[model samples]
Target: MATTVRRTSITLPAARLGPENPLPALRTPADPHQVDERERVRFPPGMARRIGYAPLRSLLPVRRLDGYDRHRTPTDLEAIVIENDRLRATVLPGLGGRVYSLVHKSTGRELLYRNPVVQPANFGLANAWFSGGIEWNIGATGHTTLSCAPVHAARVPAPDGGEMLRLWEWERLRDLPFQVDLWLPEAAEFLLVGVRIRNPHQRAAPVYWWSGIAVPESPDTRVIAPADEAWHFGHERSLRRVPVPEWQGADRTYPLRGERAADYFYEVPDAARKWITALDGEGHGLVQTSTDLLRGRKLFLWGNGPAGQRWQRWLTEPGTDGYIEIQAGLARTQLEHIRLEATSELCWLEAYGPLAADPAAVHGTDWTAARDAVSRGLEAALPRSDVERAYQAWLGCADTEPKEILATGSGWGALEVLHGRFDLPGTPFDEATLGEEQRPWVELLHNGRLPQGPLSTPPGPTLVAPHWRDLLETAPADALAEYHLGVAQWHAGDRAQAVRSWERSLKTAESCWVMRCLAVADVESGHPKRAAERYLRAFELAAEDPGQAHAVLAGLAREAVPALLAAARAGDAGALLGALPVSVRERGRFRLMGAQVLLAQGEVREARAVFDAGFEVDDLGEGEETLSDTWFAIAERLVAGAGPVTESIRRRARAEHPLPDAYNFGL
Candidate 1:
């Protein structure tokens, strides 16, 4: 099941060559660049120059000391060495196992890599080469070069070198300032890529581009994004509904695993379609066009081999590494599409260039201006009224079903326990029906959502994920009570009773495990701030022995930081400052938050002070003050003259509505 991989070559006038036309002669491997309605590959006369546009020109291996840059080092192509200081770090996990070199340049940490283990002296499995340079190759006898570039393209070693399975190294000599170009040989091809990198900063930094090719293992690959949100996917594997930590630079792949290969794309805001999976089958494939840049249009090329070879061993690799992908959209652009909020400092074009009629150079409007237009459209669409109406509509729905009830299980117990929580008119449980040991925790469940953080020590009775507590005969029975009770109360909207029932189950015995359930309840009830405070108290209680204060505080802080920042971004004062510690008033994670508030209130000088202080520090660590802290302080300074001081009132808000469901709830 092998087909020869070939690339098309083109000729251009030397006078036309300049900063643009980085690789003028480079063309599609299939010798065609046009796709008809049916998406068959087409090789139009002007397709080569059409692919060569402004944005593509922008990506002509531009070198900049501060920003993105490419380095080409002319080395003895005969022998290649990629090594780092660490012993075990020499090899990346997935590759047939290619040893890499360690450099202290970016992350200041030593890691392994295979610079570019391509195939054929001019072609790469991971990279594609296109240029008008010297020729070279390493055949059975040894290495040889003709009119190609003076390079020794390293080839991936084959366990058994069959004529169809030869490995070649394609080298782009850095010293020569040569260019190597690679494009989808097929009119539409899926490109899957895997990149494992080490961030050099002691403080976390953003990886400007999450650019990887999406390749399809099978033919039936599809791409999808949320209809509402402006962005495609935020940080973490989950979508940002209420906002959580690391929401700023999230470009993670969704969780999807199975024997079948399905390539699917999801929007950032909607948790449903975050993944672009490829199903394991033959002759089935998909393609789509993005309104973004770099990726002219996505191509899903699959079933390249014999039928029933859809789930080939190579296609089984997890993530985009196994599936084909291209860069057209990212977190920021995806977000800007759905919401009319403040603009994010992001530019996808900077990484993959821009989309244009020409594949060889950059084209279309400049990304910054294009982003501005999108913002205008978003602003027009996302009025305050629209958001409010959506919120209202979302809140009015109360279709409690068996499946949903089960899913909202807090990862605990059975149906009977869930039913008990409902004291409906027709169906009722008598006092005698109540279990003695479970009554206490059940009562707590009736109290409402538990505080955020671990609800109890030693991890409360493992009612959820029952396998963990399978040894205890009582666990199943107790779980049944909890599950039924939860469902009943939840259906009736009697949150108090339901919360109390769940809580009482934990209090059955004085074991420390009950805290987590309580914490879950708190966050679920739209009271994370309250949960944070209660967690603090619970921590104090548990601290007498094996206090998890540090761990709990750290977790809460990590979770709260991003949410608070988002609230700040959205200008929700109460949501921002309420139930929060004064220690965090204008400090740490909330530093920028506080500054935004001040700036909004017309506190110029004071705001400047905040920014000034913030600029001084580089990193924001746990409980440590940095520039972010300074920003909050500045906001505080600006607000010093306004508003009456009020102590944070810790009032219990009734669970009238369901807590905002997580985007990727289970994940």
Candidate 2:
């Protein structure tokens, strides 16, 4: 039978992706995780261009989705299945177009690690993501924002005459339109994927694309890539190139051999074939290969460390095998971004299939022979010429209109297309897809004035893109317009003008949003006390708006109470905490914050009760240390008797008051 595409499903226990926080995330990570100045000079020649680009300043237009918690129930996910005689690929269309499972029909082998549960964690850029399957990482340095979000999915004409599943989205962080087309040819062993990223704008934009594949890991599993050296990054602040396969007397190829979690960005030769594989001791497993344009390949190991093991266990069910990542990207390393010129495109073809090589050479001490064996196996399984041919064939029909539409994603893409007059040939963001979120901006774009909800209503999302900023700047000086204009200005790095704009908005009418914006500015200006006062005012304003969503109020409280505690206004913090409904206050995060507020007020006994009563932050981030830090602070306060908190006192407190396992979320 010819290749066929059909609707499918997978039901698993998944956490509730709670409502998005209705607050603008106006901050970005300030730390620079780059190679040391001395080490920079030693990097490969002409690598600076890729190493530096415009890192994001704020996720303004995309609100924070931190409200999700760890609650699980059986969930049914709609999927798309594309199968030929040899292989079957099931894609979760709603879940970032993730390739949920790829099984070889002949051998009955599952090529990818299929998780038993769809547990949401804080790994994604939007703060809610689950491990397993294959994820397409775009946007900035970390996981793509669409990790848990849906994308436009449709059925398009495949190169082999059968239909292919197409997934497209307008990536907002970089303002680029991209498409991923998956097709399995009749009787073919490999699943072919053609990806295209189009920059329809008039200026150059930084582009980042990485296809991440999670493969099952075992003690005998070894990841093979055609590279003699690699760029190694660890928990420590350093990125240095080291010998591949064997580093520091140990074979780094095995995922479980290391002591700590790390990423090894392989330095594949320009002339070498770009491919990576994770094979068992028998040298049979999955292999991912792509065209030369997709140059970078990497191996991410969770390693054998306690925190790493804990993280592994946390992502899946109680009894499940651990997994490692074999990824392919555009640049030599993910820390870098390849620049795509205006109105240009970055397109490539990738193939996933089963590979079998000589186990003796693959697992042997000789790295060159080992990689060579896998490379040859890839050439035999699916040659570079065949991949190029497939790319060309796909390009011929890339713009073929979808014969049928299956699913729809965010309306942001449609809004951008309408506003910018963008013509994406292969990927269409139809006007029919526009929804409520785009309604306000659409009105503002058509009419010259920005729309404002009632004063009793909380401020909604902000559109801080450059185009929206220009539009807002020219529109009448409405208070709401000015507030959003300030956010846009701040996003563009014009701090002084932003502050002035906020001041102007405040003069027109004081708003919680404006106050919060000013508070962030105040903190940046080294006035934490004034910032605290502004946050308190914003929290009070939040209280009066009963129409505000519960998530929004909790988000405001989360932001405000921390600022109050930072300013040592423990009484105000307690009052703000008390103002919340008991249901919201009893959540793990708020309870932890309650303990911090109590400790700040020297009420150690009351704070201890918070930790004594069991609680868990379901959405705890991968490396966040807030829970342990709060517990240690309370422990220190328990022993601090009208004395300055010293290192010795801290050590003694930690030694005597061991952090309870329930509350210890340290990484």
Candidate 3:
């Protein structure tokens, strides 16, 4: 079926480019309603600028009164014009500072802007010299540091007939002392930004820091970091990876198939690579970590997450872009296999910024030499090779599983160490496969021993008792009654309940069983604030009895520092200080944390005094070596400003002999 086609030329009148009359029909529908709600309408000059100057599209504008939804329409947009200058003032309290503000705007929604200090007042659309831009709400609470106040957006027209337009502007803020105004243009294509740091307190303040960039999830976002290696820690039976999904489709290795909960840490030591790209398959994508890239600086990575804990699978898979994260710390592999002090120093990281720059043009410092040294130091510190050799030696001596299991546990100290690190891999024996004669074999397998058979099954019942507590709650009690009950609660994910149950078990007639349960649960659920107390309590109860002490102490040592770090980041000073032992060495960390709080509180001299006094404390274990590095970095940052402190710390720590390993905490 062929159809005839006719062509005719029609001419339209030219019009002035203003808010009232835009381009003729060659342009998109001038009336906004003609476009679908989701489909954005486009106009002249601005549209050309969006396509030619700013390649990216801005989100539709909506008033705050509309709630957390996207902004749509020019009328909904707002710029905080200061109504009163006297009403807005800054306050420097001890804990991070405070900003108080009040303003009015044409937009219907309430703007909750917060910062550590420097509050901005809102003004309606009036043109005023004291105009304070939009307020940024930081954290769960709306506390934000008013180091940078972003206002004014130049709207670029959309080319593809979409509602999204590009914004271009030049911003200047007070927080960044040495840096000049950043060159972020409002056109969707360019974002030149500047930072401002305003410290009102007499004593210099340490700004607790992390950069947050929020971009909508789209199919175009592809996360990338310039790093040589990635590592992660064990979480339950799972193996976690720090770089997250290395490539787009490496989902097979993850535990929960199709589960898109992506969260992990990463470390990128290479500064040569500037920006990590998140490409939208549709040619519109975002590049991040560019602020550092623009300045030719390395990304500083710091985060507190699961370390040493084991889980079933490492990453979560999202078919499309759900979220991609890059962190500045030990990757899951390094975090798992190497100590933080040794492996973590080499990392540089990046986060969200933009995607338009030549990788070669980005200024960078070569960190390979330092990274290699860090790698070697970490390998030197690891017990992996030694453990492997020990396992080989033990195998050479004993051919029989039954004899080997008994001998290893009841063997020499070195052999026991070997046995702990290298466990034989195999599936657990099914109850159906066990005969009366095989009960002893089953018992050995259940208790985390290598079994001998064509079917060298490692019994899950014994090794994973805690994971199955819920199933066994109603089961009858035997010698393992209280122990099994506590394990069940632990396995069932009631950590608090598991701890309580384990404590209850200690009062049972079977002290040995109760002690074992208590030891494991205490580490898993004990709060850092409660850790030292419980550990001491557990030790005292087990004083005449040593089994509980060994197990609980090991667990406590492994879990305590990390728990303290978590507590510290979450702003729990009591938990941070309380986790430390009463000994002088532990007091160093307590004092250091106190200093951090003091610094946050704007008590510079007092905080310094606390650090100075605490550093004099006697060393308890090699664990303090890592703490020393943190202190050194903090001191140097305060004294010399933030730069390369890793080298200084490494040199200093090495000058001190016998690095802390007394704690023997793997994380």
Candidate 4:
């Protein structure tokens, strides 16, 4: 259905493209006859006769493609276009519902970087990521695994007085449902994007969302946002702090040729209205504003050097120029994954439009002045009240039972009222409705009284174990129940039983939490090799942001540190090497431990090499001075040997702790 209101039109049409050729499946080279039957089991019952155990593999021989391929030029494709008097926006509903293009009517300027071709790149965890357009990334890291997939889309009447284009999908990983509604009022110049995400399951899970907006990269382009500091990506999955736009005495807003890649996550100031802009020197660009619900802004760009230029060609076509991403996330930054409570819903409003302003005013540091100027200009072009009304209408159209707005009918006003009323609280388990045998265990899990780690009180676990055991016996297929049973058993000093419970839990369902528990149990049981493998598997399953992944791996590494250090001290270098988790190179503490162990064993050359593998700059935050002392000691000891301290080592040390006397210490 298509609708026209005043000078605007919303149309959904199907167009023909060409023949589809899907990418080939990725397969391991191992032969089927070489597979071990024991490894083939999803989860083995217990430790068996075989001293060595191989990991399990999927039974299916082939994998499916991410989604249907409609990018082929001659094939039939479905598209939705929303147009106003001054702006036109095109969306590819069948292609992940991506906003394919947005153009300003007056100047005929393309506000978005529209790829000349629908090219897919192997960049996401699912090995299929499409370049160009605005992609709604939800769930795990990178462009969502479903970025190349289709979504359910429809055109519906706006409650106030316009038309809305709605797209929704049930994510594959956790069955989390997400819906997005795009509205363009007849009199408004901006496009309103409303989002709703729901967790239907009864168990809590990590949820992440980022709206990725791609724009053409130019030498004079600048990313403007109201932020002072940013979390800059550093070595070893660490985050170093620097000023926004300019970091370490270098201007990063627009990179010159051969400059390093710029990936920054900024924490937006908490305000009623926050905005980020990406504009060229011509004073033509896009502005994205959101209420308090969306609080993060990010700027990512592939540098204009040969490497990045090559990557640009790889991600798209040869003639396609490099681009930058202006992203808005629901959390403080994209690196911080938000935990969505069980059976709860989250909703937010975001708006995007073409804005024309003086280049100097747009890039000014006085955010208040710049914001006031932009807001006034926007109001004059299209009244703010009309945008608010469009948002209210969108909420009514999207939700069957719309939330009542008690404040002044403005968008931000409604958000303030909703925020105060609900607080977006998590749903806790209701013990009154639980069965008798399940009540105690459910209470233990739900209530925050129980201690979770080594510092936890003893009586809590002692009191909760029997109830968890009872639930496990009655509900053998419940993965979470089995997992909690293992936790209780572990806390009660029943190590062997805990491992068995965890194995059973894995058999019920392959969860990263279960894998981590099993890994910890393996380390405690004096099986470091198995523990390392389990940790690797858990890391793979995590598929999280770099910060979260680093934190998780750091915890697991700390748990296995005792075993690793013991093996290294015993001069069992092979065991020590095997005990290190996969990607140990990406961890600062692991590198430090490896170097210290090698030094203790009198392997001066190896110690120097290990020490040369510098620690993460941001990982050693307040303890940097302490680590600097340790580094000086190590360097002094190494200098006494045949190998001399290299300039790279001194440079790295100075980069972390820039004290004047850092390298002037006597050997």
Candidate 5:
């Protein structure tokens, strides 16, 4: 299986930035003094001081601020290059192990945007980010905390037939390990990127991956994909029935212009291979494709305008032009959160390279014609059958089985009861065959929860409360029905009834959802002790269902904040920490809060311990807008006052351990 392997080194005269650099002097303002009035209003009291701020210095042509800069004199920077007959790839092990450059030998064109300079900007959660190349972002979000840190890299034989440049790193934010292998088969036009991500912890945690591919942007640049809808920013749903590329009043299929805005769109996949291509007028372009393993395809563009152009210049060198990013992810969309099961591993394959065809033939909104053109372009580079076979082998479809019908007693069946239709030909019972006692359950199963297609707005509890109540009365033994009744009751302003229903449901089946409902009721009823206990129980149940568990944990964390603060004020840091569920306590922010409280109480040792433990998990709290500053403040304080820590420990705690600022200011 091993193919020809060769490795070589190249030296690039890169700018070395420091106090002597031509760029404005870099400043690390004291944590307490770095505050923004706008952010002060949003963060909790004292939190503003802890999170610190990045001052906006120069702001006209290029904004100079606190973060990594690349404006110093030339220095010999070594880079590793791996290549085949058709393509060559270079990796910078020192700079986040990113693919610094990729070129198609035939055209002598860079497959990815090669930023001539290592210009770092104040756009990431960590306050520093470099543009261009393929940035493998994992853990918290944005470009990843490790985006600028060194990674473990080596050249090895690929599984098929070629050399692969392997890069890996342990993500401390979530305690997960991530790795990517870059392969270029001999005579093949495409480069294969195989990714492996694993959850090494004993419990599940939220995780995400975004592979950002930067390419040349121009007026004739167009995005081609087979999709009928796209999730705007991966949150707002946008439906386009006609051109599909048209959004609101603008056509996103063409190059962006005359706007100071940015757009994040994920195409709705319709085939096994989900893909998006950014092609120029000459038909020379970069196409990114993945199998079902990678579920999301995204297109990002910074419009052409004063502000947009300014931002573009800030992140790249003068001669290097602005570029658009074609990204792919392992989730439904960029903002759609996903959790990895305990000790589970996720693997997927993605390919990217040059594509050539007639611009006239490929430029359009018709997906069929556009796809054919792309296929033709790819075939011209390599054997179509060989490419197909390689892709299929990487996908490993032979071992997968067709999905079977769900068993009636499974937990997922409860969801089916809410949405499944019982009028199908294979139904076990008909209207006449059903007995009087089964009528209610049958009706509940057959009645759809919501109409087909996207909902304009969420349904009010009153709309479905009565139906759930009726189903609960008839199916007293069905825990799922009782749980649904509880949800309906809670939303209908019947807290007492909701608690009772949830308790009853727990007697039949112990579920995190029911526990979470009880916890919410207790919190509202001024029973923090009871609420804390319920939250703990719910955390234990999360191992069975990560999605539901994570949802419940989020709610619990928000509701428990006041109670934890109260306990801390009572001079009981242990009690406050213990009251938090395992999931909540494992997060970086919550642990930081606890440590700060202990430090204020003069429990220096306990505070240090708490701070050390916080570094173990990557906790991307509720939102970036609120927690980014808080996290930075906590890190700054830990470095300043985590008593007697070694130099190595301090460096690791500050740089490698803390969550990067990239997550806060997304790409």
Candidate 6:
């Protein structure tokens, strides 16, 4: 009769999100930090200012989670269900609070792309992400670092006197706390989600929020939005304005029309109702509309190119239909960041439900008519004023404290709560949730210094936020405190101070972890040789510990050998690779590096054989072209045979090689 919330479990063949990589990710993201200022597009000056604001220099303090492998086993995942008569929504609290499945009950149709398996891929900011359903992306560009992370979930009062599922987490990048509240009213077709992002700091913060909804895609489906044009961004790394629905001699609205993956940010007029839809040939599909504050909408598709098709298979289990993303955000494009003022929060209400439009109109050549028909349908189903009214109703209920705890997320939020003395009512990051990871930081907060530990033992995770950095700065100097202090200074862009702190830490104790930190600084400072030397030394020290785990050895090698190769010390890299445990050297990442070493040593054929033998880097970063690049390099060497190569010769080499799909993650 009314909406209900319940905790449950779903069994799926899921890959293990293994332990986080102990190596600090010192390099900045491959993606550019800012939108190219040269691009000519007309935007209100206020909007333009927000777009060019603060962007992340590096995802520091957040380490890579690349220890996972491709092997998966049937496992039970905790889920939260919110249901009424017409809709049933299943939320996975453990995995970024992703809405795993949304069913339109009457027709027995799954409205979202319910992923058949929990396969983790290297798509997020922190290297591990998954495909399927609806995901809330926060923090900076790329998929949120929380893609496979747990978010605190609890039961709260709903606007319509029903139960609401609240999901909240401390977004590390911008140091903000955000919450997502999901509920459905009695007999309502649409699911209501109220989202809020709070800026607790004294100064302004750059906020990025994109609610990515993955709907089932098909050859006949066409995405429609209330805009005549869109800002198109493609694999070519450029952005330009293009007509909506039809572009580049094809109806770009259809996900399969293009040959490569792309993002289409619809230029929704300020006064227009914010909505986007993807309906099939028969005119029934999902529509997502949000209140005006969530101003931007987008369509992202893995087009019908070979790489795109291959990527779809790589991200999921075999024999399943793929999906396209319809996303909503605060800025006009994903590249831009919106400025959230100090002590203020941004709130918006979004509705997702099935929409039925005229098949002829939806699939017609007239883009305006198709979009208008869908917008009118959305209005008839749930009017803009009603959505606004719902937001007002939600605000009153949003502060109502949780009735019960459904699930628990990371202790990072609670650590922030304790540090800042935040007064978050409805979404409480309780002190009880603080665990082993936050234990040291908790001590640093209540006590004066970071607890000292043996140099042989790896350091715990670092905190680089201004508040934590201040504490680390005031703490008594020691190897433990100085090492973490360097990380914080580096995050703040004080490279000189970071180097000084690490060098001083070395006097107190010799640590591979601190040496690795210094090596990262060396690399950033353009001293590749110095970096290589430090990396090699770090690995040597780490190797001296006979009782160390294989993973530690493998992880250190993964960082060191790359630096050695970068410095043109391939011989040293080869020796390091040889020193690895046989099992470690055989891993895809090390094997790939080994092939590079062979190529450098003039053993081109041997390098080529490694590619021919076939291997997969399960932890490869998204858009990393190393696999295909190395493949082509070997092919070119074999073709030239110690001769001077020309462009045509390169072309011939590639023609002969014809990189396999397994290695072609180029886009």
Instruction: Give the Cα lDDT of each candidate.
Output: 0.26, 0.86, 0.27, 0.56, 0.55, 0.88
TM-score winner between candidates 4 and 6: 6
Candidate 4 per-residue lDDT over residues 417-518, each given as its tens digit: 221232222111122323433333444444522222321111111222243355444543456656666765665457688789879878877755677778
TM per candidate: 0.27, 0.96, 0.23, 0.54, 0.51, 0.97
- The number of residue pairs in model 2 that clash at the backbone is 0
Q: What lDDT score is found at residue 187 in candidate 1?
A: 17
Sort by lDDT, best first: what order?
Answer: 6, 2, 4, 5, 3, 1
Pick by lDDT: which candidate is best? 6
Please give the ranking of all candidate structures by TM-score, highest first, separated by commas. 6, 2, 4, 5, 1, 3
Candidate 4's C-alpha lDDT? 0.56
Q: Point out the worst 10-residue segment of candidate 3 by lDDT.
A: 59-68
lDDT of 3: 0.27
What's the residue-level lDDT of 96 in candidate 3? 17
- State the displacement of the C-alpha of residue 19, model 4, in Å, after optimal TM-score superposition: 15
In model 4, the runs with Cα more than 4 Å from the true position are 1-76, 234-236, 255-258, 363-389, 400-667
* Candidate 5, poorest ten consecutive residues by summed lDDT: 454-463
Q: Give candidate 2 regions above 4 Å deviation.
A: 30-39, 639-641, 658-667
Clash list (residue pairs), candidate 2 = none
1-667 in candidate 6: lDDT tens per residue? 6789999999999888888887767677777324566653555566567666777788877877777778889999999999999999999999999999999999999999998988888888898899999999999878999988889999998988888999999898898999999999889999999999999888999999999999998999899999988988887777778997788799899998888999999999999989999899999999999899898999999999888888898888789998999999999888888888999999999999999998988988888789888988888999989899999999998778888999998888889989989898788888899998899899899898877787788787889988899999999999989999998998888889999999999999998989988988888889999999998988898889887667777887887887888899999999999989887788799899999999988999999888889998887776788898888888888899999778987999999988887788877
lDDT of 1 by residue, 1-667 (tens): 2212221222211111011111111111111111232211222223222222211111111111111012223322222222112111121111211222222222342211122322121112112221111112111011111112122121221111211111112111110111111111111121111111122112322221222333333232222222222212211222122221112342122112122221222323322222211112221112122223222221122222321132222112113223334323333321111111121111111111111112111111232332233333333423324333322332222111111100010111122234233221111123433443344445444443222233343322212212122222233325334433433343334557656765765555432223433443566677666555444444345444554433333234333444433333324433434334454343333455455555655665755655556421111211123333333333343345355322221111112212122100111
Scored by lDDT, model 6 comes in at: 0.88
Across 1-667, the per-residue lDDT of candidate 5 in tens digits comes to: 2233344455543443221111111122112113235644554343343233212221111112222234444555546676777778777766666788888887899878787777655444343567788888775445565655656555554656445666665554454566676677766678887777766455776677888888888888887765656644321222122335666687766657426444445555545456777888888888877656676777777776554554576566566677888888876455433668886778777777887877777776565677678766765654435545665664442122212211111122122223333221111212332343333444555552222211111111111324345554454345666665666566445768877877887888786667766876776688777776776666456534533433344444444454445434434434545555675565555565566566556566666565444352222211233334444445545666656556665565568445542323322
